[model samples]
Target chain A: MDKNLWRWIELNEYETPSVPTTMLAKRWWQKMLQTLRPSRVEVSTANSAEEEPKGVEFKFDEQPLLDSLNTLLDQQNQDDPRVTWLVLAPASPAWSVIRKWANQNGWQPVSMPQRDSLLTSSSVDELNIPSEPWVVDDLSHGFVRHPLGIRWLQNFLRKTLQTPQSPGLVICGSWLYYYLEKTHGGLNRQALTLRPFDTESMVTSRIAVSRAHAKRLVAVSEGHPGIAAAYRNAFAVAAEQTEIVLEMPQVPTAHGETSTFVIYALLLHGGLSTFLLGEVLNSIAPNLIEHSLNLLRSHGIVRYQDDQWSVTELGYPAAKQFLAQRDFNWTSC
Target chain B: MDTQKISDLFKTVDSNAALQVVTIILIAWLIVFLSQRLLPRLANLLHSKQRLYTLALIPLIRLVVVIVALVMLVPIFIEPTLKNMVAALGALGLAIGFAIKDYVSSLIAGVVAIHEMPYRPGDWVTIDGVYGEVTHIGLRTVELVTPDDTVVAMPHEKIWQHAVLNANNGGPSLMCVAEFFLTPESDGLVVKEALEQIALTSPYLQIHKPVVVTVNDEPWGTRYRLKAYPVDPRQQFKFITDLSLRGKQRLLDLKIEFAKVETAKVN
Candidate 1:
C-alpha cells in the first residue's frame, strides 16, 4: 500500500470497507469518532503488550479546527526527491502526532528533514482570508486574539504565501474566506465572528450580513433581511453530500482488507457544494456534544490541555458564558 | 531596698529577648491569617497551582514583618544595644546553628523553590517515576495526581534530585502514534506517499507539525506510523485513533495486504 494511502486509512479517510468485519470495525470506529470529534485520538496496535502511549509532550500547535485546515495548504514545504506529497492541511494537534510518528519510523528517512513553513503563518489571514469577518470569526474568534500576535502571524504567512506561490483552488467557500468577495475583517479584527460551535449555515448568514453592508443593503432594498438569511441552512444541506455510507454494504474492494471511498453523493442541484475525497471523518467519537466542540476547535475557538480542555484567549468570555448556561442556571429569566 | 529586688526582676525579664519573641509570634500569626485569602487569589488570577510556593511567601512575609517590627521597636526594648546585640548574636551563632541545622536548610530550600518556580499547581509532572498533575506546591513537598488518578506527595528535595518531566509547560500537547502494518513487499515508497498525503489532507494536522513515518526493523512487513496531533492536547487518543483506523481503511481500499504489527517490547 502507498504511504499516502496508509495515511488515508489511518486517518479514517471519511469512508470504510463494506465487508462484514471491516464494516463492523468501521462502525465501531465511526461511533467512537462521532463521539469524540474534537478530541485527540491514540490508536493502540500492540498485540500482546497493553501499554498506553507515554505521557504527552507539551508544546502542540493545532489548538483550533480551522488552524488544521489552513495549515494543510501552507506554502513552505521540504524538498524530497523520493517522497511525493499529495495534500497538505492546516497544522493541528492531530497532524503533529502523525508527522512525529512517521519520522520515527524511518518511513521518511532521516536524510529528509520535514519541511516546515518558511514563516509562521498568521491564523487570522489564514482564517480570515475566507471572506466574511463573521464567517471566519464565527469559526475561530474564540481561541486567540492579540493585535501584534495577529500582525506578526500575517507578516509571517504573507512572506510564506509569497513563496511557492500557486493559484489557490477556490472551492465552494474558500473564495469568500480569502477576501475574494469583499473587504472583510474591517469592523472585526479577529476571524470567525461567532463561536466555533455555530453551524456552517449560521456562519453564512453572518457573512451575508457583512457582505451586504450599508451600500449593499441600500441596493438590496426591502428584501435585504430575507436575502441575508437565505444561506442559513445552505451549507448544512450541502454538507450532507458527504456520503459517509454509515452503512457500507456493497463496496468493491479487496477481501479481508478494509476499503475507504469518497462517493459523490448528490450532484449540484442548484446551489454550490464542495466535497473532499476523504478517507474517514477527522473526528472519532462524533457525538452531539463532541460535534459542537469539533466545530468550535475546527474554527479556532478553544484548546486541549493536560488531561483537560479549556477555552483559548478569544473563547474565554463565551466559554464562561457557556459554563454559566451549562453548569449554572441562566434560563430562569 | 525593695526597688533593688524589682530591678533584679527586670534584668531577668530581658526585655529585648521578650520583644523578639513577641514580634516573631505576632508576625507568624499575621502571615497565617493573610495567606488564606492571598494564595487562592494568586492561583486564580495568575492561573497557577503552586500553593506550596505561594504558601512559602507566608514565612518570608512573616520574617520581613518581624524584622521590620523589631527594627522599629528596638529602642523601646533596649537602649544603645546595637553593638552589644551584634556581639551577643556572634556569641550564640555556632550554638544556634548546631541546634537548628535541619530547620535552616529546609527554610533555605523553601526560599529557593518559591523564587525558582520549577513546578506549579495544575501542572502535570513526573519525578522519580511518579507522574501526575500538581495539586499543591509545598515548602518542602510537592503534591501531584497520577493519570490513573492517584495523588502523590513528593518531597521538594526529591524533585530537585531526579529528572522531572513537565507535561503542560505552557499548554498541553502530546506526541501520538498511529500505527499500520502492511505486506513487506508493499511499496514502502507508495505507503510513505499515501501517509504523507493523509497527513497533508487531514484537518487535524498542525504547523509545528509532528515527525512522521517510522518503518520498523521487523520481518513480517513494514510499519507506517503517522505521528499527528489532536485538535487539543487532551484529545490525543481520539486523534491517533481516527488517523490509524482511517489510514488503514484507505490502504485496504487500495487492495493493500497487511502484516499486522506484532506486540512491541519496550525494555
Candidate 2:
C-alpha cells in the first residue's frame, strides 16, 4: 500500500483489507489505481452499500451561527412568512457549512444551476425549482455577474414575496449578495453575514496547541476556515519532516508614503488611468510613476490593462490589512 | 616655520608613502564612482517612498569615504608624529586659507550643510532665485536639476547669505497650490465646497493630509486657492494641474465665469 493510503486508512480507522469503504476512500483508491495503471484502466461504476455522500464535511464551529439563523427564521415564520432570508457569506467553507446545517435542520438544500443552465431555459418554470424552503449553495461562482442569473433571482424573489405562505429561502455567496444588496433595496435588514472564527475561538478549537501558534494561524489566514485548515495541514507535514516549528510570516505595513497613496487610489477608484495616476502623484515625475508601477507589477500587487491600473486579488488583502491597521476602512474607500 | 623644516616636510614624501597615498585616493575615487552609479539604480529599482531616503545616503556615504581616505593619506604623505602633522597642516592651511578665501569658506559651509541638512539629494528646494530638485550635495556645491531639466551647481557659501527654501525638507510629500480666478459675483460658498471636493476626489491627494480652500476678493476677481499635498513631492506640478483642470471644469459646469484680464502698461 502507498504511505498516503496507509495514513488515510489509519486516520479513518478502517480495517486492513476487508473493511467497507466510503465514497471518499473508494475515490482515492480509484485515483491511485489510475495513476499506477497509466494505460486503459476501467473505473468500476458499481454502487456500494457503505458509500458516503459526495460532499465536503465542515469541521468549523457553527452552532452559534445555526442558533442565530434559527432565531431569525422563527421570527420570520411568525411575522412575515413571505420574506426570503439572505445568508450572505464569501464562497468557501462557510457556504458549505451553512448548506450542511440547513440540510441537517430539515430545510432542503438546493444547489443553484450553472450560468449556462439558466441561460438555456427561457422561462423560470422550465427549471422546475422546488416550492419547499431551500438553501441555495454556490449562488455566484467565479464572481462573474450574469444578467440571466440576476433575472432568475429577481423572478424568484418576486414569486416568493407574492406567495402568502412561502417557504423561507437561504441564499449564499458574495457576488450574488452584492448584486441583490445593490438592486434589491428592502433585503438589507433580512441579511445574515457569516464571518469566520475569531482568534479566541480558533485557539480554543485546536487541542494541545499554543495560543501563539493559533494566533499566527489566524493572522496568516485572516481567520478564513479553509485557509486556516490548509495552513494547518501544510504545517503538520512540514513538522513531520523538519521536527521544528516554522517562523510566522511577517505582514507588510502600509507606512510607505507612495505605496499608501497607490493602494488608497486603487481602492477608491477601483481602477485609474495612467495619466490620472501620474497627475494624482503630481510631485513624482512621469518616468518615476512608470518605474514604481513596474515594481508593483513585478511584485504581483498591481496590474495594468487598457491604460488603467488596479490592484490584483493577491494585493487586495494586503492593502486591506494595511489600511485596517491604520484605522482606515477599505470598504468606505 | 623655518625654511629647513619646510624643505624637510617636502623631503618626507617617500616612494612607499606616495604609493599608499595614491592607493587611498584611488580607493576613495572608486567608492564614490561606484556608489554614484549604483545607488540611484538600486533606489529606483526598489520603487518605494524609501527611495528618496536611500538616494540621499549616497552623497553622505561618499563624503565619509573621502574623509577616511584623506585621514589615512595624511600620515603617509608627511611624518606620522602628531606635532609634525599639526605644524605642517597649520602652515598649509594659512597659505591656502589666504589664497582661496571663498573656496575655504564654501568648504567649511559644506561641512555645516551636511550636519544641518537643509536639503538632501532628492529634496525639492529653491536657493536664491533658482528652484529645482537637489540631485547631488557635493563638498563645495549642491547640484540641482530644475523643472526645465537644467542642472545648476550652487555653492554652499550662499547658504550664509541666502535662505534655502525646502519644499519637502527630508520627507517624500510636498504641498501644492492650485489657484482659480472667478468673477467677483460668483457664490464663494459654492465655489469653496466644489474646490474642496476637487481636492478630496483627486487620485493623487494624500487623504491623511489636510486640504484647504482659501478665497481673497481681488479688484479683478475672486481668487480661490486650493492647497493640498501630493503623495510624493515629485507629483506637485501634476497634482496642481489635475486640480486646476478639474476645478475649472467644475466652475464651468456651475456656470461660473473667469475674470477679464487687464492689459499692463509698459514703461
Candidate 3:
C-alpha cells in the first residue's frame, strides 16, 4: 500500500516513517510533489468528490494541489529541507501517500533494507509490546482504559518519526488523542478530528479538542463547516480545493507542561542541589511534594531525581518524532 | 546323657544370670520411658531454651530412644552382636516398607518438601491453580488462606508431585488485562474519553497505575479494550465485575453498544 516509501530510502539515508493515521500528512506529501510538478495536479480532499455535482462532468480544485506540488518542487529545486507533506483520509493513510508523493518527485524511494524493519506490522507484533500492569486489568483502579495507551500511542508516534525522507507522521485514534497530548510534552503538532458522520454534538467535541489549546487542530469533516468556532482558528469555504497551511500549529501544551514543569523544577531545584533541598519539595504537607509531583508525573514526560523530575532523554526525541510523523488525531503535534 | 546332666546343673542360676536375657531389655525400656515423659516436664520446670525445639524434635527424639532400646535388647534377647542387630533391622525393612508403603512414600516426600520449600507458612502461593496465603505448616499437611478467607488444607504428598507457581517470587504484584468490545460505528473518540475518565476516577488505583487501551476493527464495531491496574489481586473478580458494570453503564448512556467478541480459529 505504501510502496513509494521505497523511493525515499534510496534518496536519503534517513528512514521514511511508516503508515501514519493522519490523512493530512500524506496529503501534504502529495501536495508537495504536485506543487513541484507545474503541469500535474494531485487529488484534493475537499474537491475529490465534491466537484462532481450531478455526476458526469466535474472540475477538480487544482490550486491547493498546485500549491503543494509547487512548494515541494521549489524546495527540491533549491535543496531545501526534504519537505514531504501528507494527509490522512479514508482513501489514504499518511505513509501510503508519502510513497506516492516521493515517487512522483522522481526521488528513488527507500525500500526495506532488511526483511525486518521494526515498523512492519510483523515487527510491531513481534515486539509484543510488553503489557503494562494497567493494560489488562486496573479494576483496582476505576478507570475504563488504562493510562498506558497514552504512552503506547506516544511511542508509536516516536517510531513513525524515524522514517527517511518521507515526513514522519502518525494517525492517532480519536479516543486517546487528547489524553496523549495532555500527558506527553505535546509540541508543535496539529490535532485532527477524523469525523465519521459530522454530527452536531461530535462537532462540538471536535471543536473543543481543536480549540482546547491555543494550537490549531485541523478538523477533517466530510462537508459541513462543522461548528466553526470550536477551532483555535477556523478555515472553511464552499470550495473545490482544500487549503491547509504547512505551518506547524501553535503549541498550547503549556497547561500540561506547566504542571509537569513544576515537578521538574522541584526535582532539579531540590534533589540536584544542596541548598534547595528540604526548602522545596520536602515531602511535607503544605509542602505536599507528593501532590505536586503527582501532577508532574501524570504526564509520561516527567522523570525523577531524589524528590524531583524532568523530561527524559526520550522527551526531545519524542518532540522531534512528533514533528516528523505529524499524523491526524485529537492532537497531531 | 550329657544334655540331661547339663539341665540339672543349670537349675541353680537366677533369672538375673539367665544369660542376662530379659533383665537388660526391661531396663532399656525403663530408660526410654523416663526420657519421653520425664524430660519434657523437666524442660518445662526449668524453662529451658530447648522448649522451642521440643515440638519440632519429638519424632526425632522418639526415634533415637527406640533405636537405643533396640540396641540394649539385642544383647539380652539373642546375644546378637551390634553388627548383627543392624543387619537384622535392614533385612526387616523390606517387609515394613511393604506393609506401610504409602506412609513410607509420604514420609520421603515430606523430607523432600522440607528441602524443596514449595511453600512455607506466611508465603502467598498458588498451587494447582488455587491461590491463597500460606497459614500453617504441618508434618503431613499445609494450610492456605483463600481470597474468600477460607482455609485450604493440602497434603505434603500433593506438593511433591504437582507444580506450584509463586506470584510474589518476582514481586507481589501481578499484571492483568481486561478487554471490552464495541461496534466499529461506536465513536472511539467517545470511548477513549470515557475510559480515561474512569481510570482516573477509579478508587482502587495503584501507586503506579498503568491503564491502557487498544482500538481494533471488529465485525460488530471497534474493539475498544481498556487495561488497568487493580489495588489488590484478591478482589480481581469484583474489579472485573465493577468495570463491566460501569463500562456497560457508560456506553449505555452514550448508547455505545457492546460487541459480541469471539476469536476466530484459523485452522
Candidate 4:
C-alpha cells in the first residue's frame, strides 16, 4: 500500500533538507543567548517512550522498500560486467530492509568473513561467490580500522569491480559510505540510496502529524525517516493529530574530544562491539573509553544493543548536529 | 608660518568634541574586546574551515576598528589640509621615532603581518625557534601558547629577520611526520610499506590527504619518515603520537631493531 513512497536515487544525488532562514536565525540567537547567559545542564530522560500517542499509530509498510529494491535490480544493466549495485543504508532502523527483500526474493545474502581470514585469503575464490545474484548485508562489517583488518575490504572491492563476477549488491552504512568515498573514490560513483523524506513528502504522507510539526521534524532530522520516526515518537497525539513537545532534545553536547570521537567512530561503523571499538580507538585509554561511552549512553546519544554499541535513532539528529558543528567528516544525508 | 597659521592646525577642542572622542573610544574598545573574547569561543564551536576563517577575521576586525576610530578622531584634533597633516605627522614621527623606534617598528610590522598573513590565530607556527599556536595577533606582539602551555609574546618585528614557519598556514590540514631509525639489517621496502599502513590506519588521519613514506640512508641506520595529515591542525601532536606509538609497535612486530645513538649526558 506504501508503494513508491520513497524514490531510490544515486547516493551522490541525495541532499539534506535545507533549513529555513528564520529557523536558522532563531537557532543562532538561542546559541548566542546561551553563551551570553550560562544555564543549568539540560538533562534528558531515557523513558520518553511512555509519551507515545494514545490512539494514532502508523506501522511501516515494507512494500515500498521492496518495490524500490526491485526497481534498482531492473535498472541494473545485466550485460555490463563492470557494474555492481552498492546501497548505503542509514544507521537507524537496526534491521536491513534490503536483506529482508533479498531473502523474500530468493537472493542469497553474504555475511562478512572473520577479520583474520582477510589477511590470509589470496583470491576472489575465498568469497565463495554464489553463481546467482547475491546481497552482502552490511559492508561496514567487512573491515576494521586497523591495518591488517582492511585487506578484506580492499580485496572484496577489487573482486567486485576488477574481475568479472556475478551481479551483486553491497550495502554499506551511511557513515561507512562517506568514509569509503574518501578512501575509495571510484566506487562512490556507482552507489545508490533511498531518497530523503523532505517536508513536502512528510506533509503529504499518511502520517498524522500536523504540517508545522512535519517541518520541524524535517529540519531536525535532516529528512532521515528513521531519525524522524524516533523524534516523532515524542509527540503527543490528540484526535489523530500529533502535538510537538518543546522538551525534545535539540543537539547533544559532547563534553570532550574523547566523547566526540567515540560518537563519531560508532556512527562511522554503524555499530561496533566493545572490543572492536577499543581496537579502533587504541590511542584512547580503556578506562576513558568506558567513561565516555557511559556518559553518552546516559545522554541517550548512544546505546548498546544487539551486541553492538551505536548512536541511537532518537539521539541521531542531535549527535549529527554535534558532529557537524565540530566539523567531523559526515555522510551527505 | 605665523603663530596664527600654526594655531589654525588645531580645531576647537570643545567638551562636545572631547565627549565624541570618548564615545568613539568606548565603542571601539567594546567591539574589539567583545570580538576578541567571543570569536575564539565561536571558532572553537565550529569545524576546521569556518574556525580558521573566523579566527583570521579577529585581527582584521581589530585593524578595521582601530583604523575607523583613528579616522573619526583625527579630524577632531587637526585641520583638514595636506600641509597641516604633513607638518603634524612629521613632528609626531620625530618624537615617536626617537622615543619608541622598536615599538613603532613592531606596530608597522603588525600591519604588514596582517597583510601578508604569515600566521593566523589558529595556525601552528614556529618563529625565532619558538613554536606554538598563534593565539592572538596584537598591535606590537603576536601571542603564542606553546606546546607546554606557556604563553610567549614575540614582537611582530620578528617578521623582519626571523623565518615564520607555518605548519598548516591557515588551513586545517597539518602534515605530521613520524620518524624511525632502524638498523641497516632491516629491510627498507618492508619498513616503508609498514609505515604507510601505520599512517593510513591512524584514526586521527585526514583520509582525503595522501599518506607518504620516505626512506633515507643514514650512516647510523636506515631512516624512514612516515608523513600524513590530521583532520584538524590542533590534532597534529596526537596524530604524531599515534603514528609513533603504532609505528614502533608494528616495526617491532616485524622484529626490526632500532639504531642506538650514544650521546653524552648533561647534568
Candidate 5:
C-alpha cells in the first residue's frame, strides 16, 4: 500500500480540495437547464431508473487504513515515547477504524458510562480511566451535550492528561473535537487526522473517477473517506459509465429553530440516539424531535443505524454549510 | 416684492415637470422600499457580521435614495439662482420651524444616527424605556421589535436627550449573564467551578469568548454570576436560560441550596 494512502496530518492541516470554479459553473448551468427543461430531466430520470444499478456500493476495506495507521504509529512511537496520538475521524463511520485497530492490537478500550450514569455529578469523579496503553475508540461517546454529560469527559480528560500515565491513543470524531475545542479549549496535544482525498489519490480501477467527479467528491466530502466513498457510490450510474454526474446533496430546509438545533446537536456529538438527543434537547418535545429527525432523514440529511442517528456522509457537506449559514459554530472538516 | 417678481423666483408650474417630480419620488420610494424589504432577507441568509453590515445598509440606502431624489426634484420646483434658492429655503425653513420642528429635528437626527451608527438594524438597543432588536431605521423614527414581539417606533430625536444602550453595536458578540443566589452556607468555590462548567457545556455558548464565573457576597447570600457569550447575539436569551437551568440543576445535585429572598427584593 502507498505510504501516502492514509497519510496522517495534523487536524488543522487537513485540507479538502476546493470545488473548481468550472465545476461550480457547470453545476449551476445544469441546474438552470433542468429548471428550464423539466421534460428532459424527467426522461433522463426514467431512463436512469432502469439503467442505473440499485446501488453502487464503494466499500473500502478498513484493513488498509488500519495498516497504514499502524505504520505511522510505529514511526511516531519510535520518534517520541512521551507523545499522545489523537486520531480525529469524521462523524459518519463513527469509530470503526479505531475500534478495529484496538481489537487487533488487543489494546484496552475505555468503557463509556451509560447515559443515565452520566447524568449524575459524581459520575465525573467516579470515571475510571483504563490503566495504560488504552484506546478510546471515539471520544465523542464519552460525553453528551448536556451539563452533567460534559463533567465526565472533562474529568476523564484531566485524568488522562495530568496523571503520570503511559502515552495512549484516543480517537475522537472531528465534530466533537471542534465542539470541545470551543467549549473546553480542546486538547492541546499532537493530533493525527486522515488526509483528505484529492483527484490524484481518488482514481481507481473499478470506476475511473473523472477529474470533475474527484473534485466534486473531495469538495463535498472535505476529504473525508467515508463521505467520499458514499458520494462515489451514490453518483455512479454504472461501473462502465465514464462520466459520473456528481451533484451536491440538497440540504433539507430547516423551517424552524428545532430542526436547526437538532442538526447542530447531532453534528456536535457526532450523532446521538433518539433518547440521548431528547436528553440533550430536553426542552424540545420528543415528538418534535422525532418529527425533525424524520424530516431530515427523508431529505437524506441524516441516517439511523445501530440505534443512532448521524449526519449521512453525503449529507455532511450540505448540512455543514446549512448550519454555517445560520451562524452555527462548527469544527473544520 | 412685486407679485410678478416673486412669481419669477419659481419655475412655471408644468404638468410634465410635476409628472417628472412624481416619477422620481416614486422611483426613490420603490428603491427604498425594496431595500428595506430585501436587504433584511439577504442579511438573514448571511453570517453574523455580514448580516449586521447588510442590515445597516438599509438606512444608508434610504438616505442615498432620498438625497438623490431631492437633488433631482429641487431643480424642477425652484430656479437655480442663489437668490431664488435662499428665498425658497427661507420659506421652507419658516414652515418647518413652526409647523413640524420636532419632525425635522428627528429627520436630521436620523441622518446623524446613520453616520454615528449608534444603533443599526439587528442591534439590540434600548431607547427611553423600550428594549428590543432594532428592526428598521426610518427618516424620523427607529423601529424595534421587543422580546414580547411588540414593535415600538422611537423618534430619532431620542438620541439627543436620551442615552441609547446598544448591547451589540454591530458585532455578533454579546455577553449574557446567568445569576444564581446560593445560600451563604454553600461553598462559593465549588459553586463557581460548577457554574463555569455549566456555561462551558452549554450548546449555545460561543466557545471563542471567555466564560467567567464571578462569585460575590451579597446581603442575602452568595451571588454567582456565570457570564459567557453566545454564538449569536440573538441566542442570548436561550444561552442564559440554558446556563441558569443547568447551573441550578448542577447546584442542586451538589446538595447546595438557593437563597430565598423577599418578593420585594426579587422584584
Candidate 6:
C-alpha cells in the first residue's frame, strides 16, 4: 500500500478498508485510491491525522466549482506565494463560490467591514486573523468618497503582504477590483474576471427553456450573474407576463431661441469644447449659449469635463424623442 | 414640290399607331408626375446625408423620360431612317430657330447645363443678380426659391451671357458670412477670436471646414467678417443668424461697443 494513498484516503474521508487479504481485492482498493489521490494531494493540506474529516466529499452541492477553485489555488500557490489573486466578478454566485472554496480549503475569507462597522471596530482586531491565505471581498466599498477607507485598505494590504504566515489573498467584486486598480495600481496582484454564463451555458443549466428565452435572458441580464438569476426567477414564475421595460429619461424642450440650436449641436457632434459649442450656436448670444449650457448641465442632460461637453447616456434617448416631437429635421441641418 | 416623295417619306397615320403614340405620351406624363412627386417623397423617406443627391436626380430622370418618349413617338409618326429624320428635323429646326432664337438658345443651354452640370437641383446659385436655391431645373428655365420664399423662374439662356455664382455647386454644404463692426479702440485680436469662437460653437456650423475671421480697419470702425460653412445649404440663413446673435452677445459681454450706425454707413 502506498503511503501517499493512505494520506489521500484519510484527507478525503474515504474509508480505509482493512488491507485486503486477497490479491484481486487489494488491487481494486489500490486502483480506487489512486484515482482519488490526484485530486486530494494536488493542494497541500496541514490536516493532522488525529483530526476527523468534518464533511463528506459529496455533501456540498457545488462540488465541481469547488474542485476547479482548488486546482486554481494549487496552481497559484505553486507559482508565487506572494502574489494575491484579484477576482473581478459581479456579486452573487462568484462571491459565494470564492467564500465556500476558501473556507473548505482552510483559508480565511474576510470582507471589507461596513463603513459603520469600521468606525466602531478596532483595525488591529480586524487585521489579526488566525488563518493563512486571506480573501479580501469588496475592497471598493467606501473608497470612492472615503479617504480614510482607502488608507486603511492600503495599510491592511501592506501588512498582509509582509506576513509570512499568510500564503495569499483573493480580492473579489468588479467594482472593488476596478477601484483598487485605479487607486492602488492593483497592488501587483494577478486578476481573474468571472463572467456570467453565456447563452449556451444558460440553456444547458435550465432544463425547461427555449433557446429564444435563453438568449433573452442573456440580453436582459447584460451578462451579470446576479441580474441573470433575478431575471430567470422572474421568468420562471410568470414566463408570459414578464416584461422588461426600459424607461428613458425625458429631455426638457429647449424653449429659448438658442437652446434648440445648442442641444442640436451637442446631438450632432457628441463632444465639443466650450469654444466649439459657442461657434456652433454663434447666431445665439454668447451669453445665451452659456446660460443654456448651464441650464442643461443643471438638469443632468449634459456633462462638462476636461473643457469638453458631452450629453449623458440618459440625455441621448430623451434628446432623440424631444427632437422627433419637435419635428426638427437633421437633414436640413 | 415632290408631293408623292414627301408622302412616301412620312409614315401614314393609322388608329393603332395613334393609340401607341397616346400611350407613349401617357407613360411619359406618368413618369414626369411620379418623378416630380415620388422622388421628393423617396428623398424624404430615405434618412441619410445623400437625400439631396437623390433629390437632384429627379430632374434628370424626368428629362430622360421626355426625351425617350419623343424618340419613341418619332418612329411611329414619321419614317424611322437616319437620313429622312435629319432632313425633316433640319427644315423644322431652321424655321423654329429663326422664330424663337431666345428659346432655341435657352433650350440649347439647358442641354449644355445637363452635360456641364454648372447647376442642379438643390444648388444655391446666383444667376443675373438673383440669388436663391435651385428647386427645379426645367428644359428651358431653372426655378429658384429665394430666402424671402419667393419662387423665381430664370431662363437657362442667362448661362450664355452671365456668370452663374453657385455657392454650394452640387454639394450639400454652403458657406455663410456674418459681419461684426466694433469701435476702433476695441482689441482687434480679441474681437477676431470671439467671432471665430462664435462660429465654432454654432449648431449648424460644419466643424470639419475652416472658420475664417477677417478684419479690416476702416475709417468708420474695425470691420470683422466671420466666414464659415453650414452643414447644409438650406440652413445657411439659420446658421448665419445663430452666429450673428451669439457673436453680438459675446462682443457685448466683452464690453465692446458696436460702431455708430452713421459711422458704419459712411464706410
Against the hidden reference, what TM-scores do the models get? Answer: 0.38, 0.58, 0.29, 0.88, 0.89, 0.52
Candidate 3 residue spans exceeding 4 A from truth: A1-333, B1-96, B120-126, B129-131, B179-201, B209-242, B260-267
Which lDDT tens digits does candidate 1 get at residues B1-267? 255532332224377777766776686667756764566455332211233345445445644655576576545443535554664455457755889665555555555655665655555577898877666555566777776678787766654467778765534344667888788888887677556545533434432344477787467777777775433343455556666765776677567888865688999
Scored against the native two-chain complex, candidate 1 gets a DockQ of 0.02
Candidate 5 clashing pairs, residues 3+ apart or interchain = none
Q: Tell me the alpha-carbon RMSD of every candidate.
A: 21.4, 15.4, 27.1, 3.7, 4.4, 21.1
True interface contacts reproduced by each model, as a fraction?
0.03, 0.05, 0.00, 0.45, 0.47, 0.12
- Please, what are the lDDT tens digits per residue for candidate 2 over residues A173-219? 43334334433554443554434444554555551045555555555
Each candidate's B-chain TM-score, in sequence, is: 0.52, 0.93, 0.48, 0.95, 0.94, 0.91
Candidate 2, residues B127-205, lDDT tens digits: the string is 9999999988788899999999999999999999999999988876688999999899999997887687677656566
How do all the candidates rank in terms of DockQ, highest first? 4, 5, 6, 2, 1, 3
Give each candidate's interface RMSD in Å. Answer: 15.2, 15.4, 26.9, 2.8, 5.4, 21.8
Q: Which residue ranges in model 6 land beyond 4 Å of their true spot? A: A1-333, B1-5, B44-48, B261-267
Q: A94-139, model 1: which lDDT tens digit per residue?
A: 3334344333322322111111221123232332221111111111
What TM-score describes the B chain of model 4? Answer: 0.95
Q: Which is the leading candidate under DockQ? A: 4
Q: Write the per-residue lDDT of candidate 6 for residues B1-267, one digit (tens) a residue.
A: 277766766888899998999899999999888788877765543322455677788778877997899899888868778878787777678877789888888988988887798888788899999999888888889999999999999999999999999998787667899999889999888787667656644556554467788888898888899999876577789888877877788788778989985623654
Instruction: State the TM-score of candidate 6 restricted to chain B.
Output: 0.91
lDDT of 3 by residue, B173-211 (tens): 444455677767778887886675455433333324456
Choose the strongest candidate by TM-score. Answer: 5
Candidate 5, residue A77: the lDDT equals 48
CA-lDDT, candidates in order = 0.37, 0.59, 0.39, 0.76, 0.75, 0.59
Between candidates 2 and 5, which one is better according to DockQ? 5
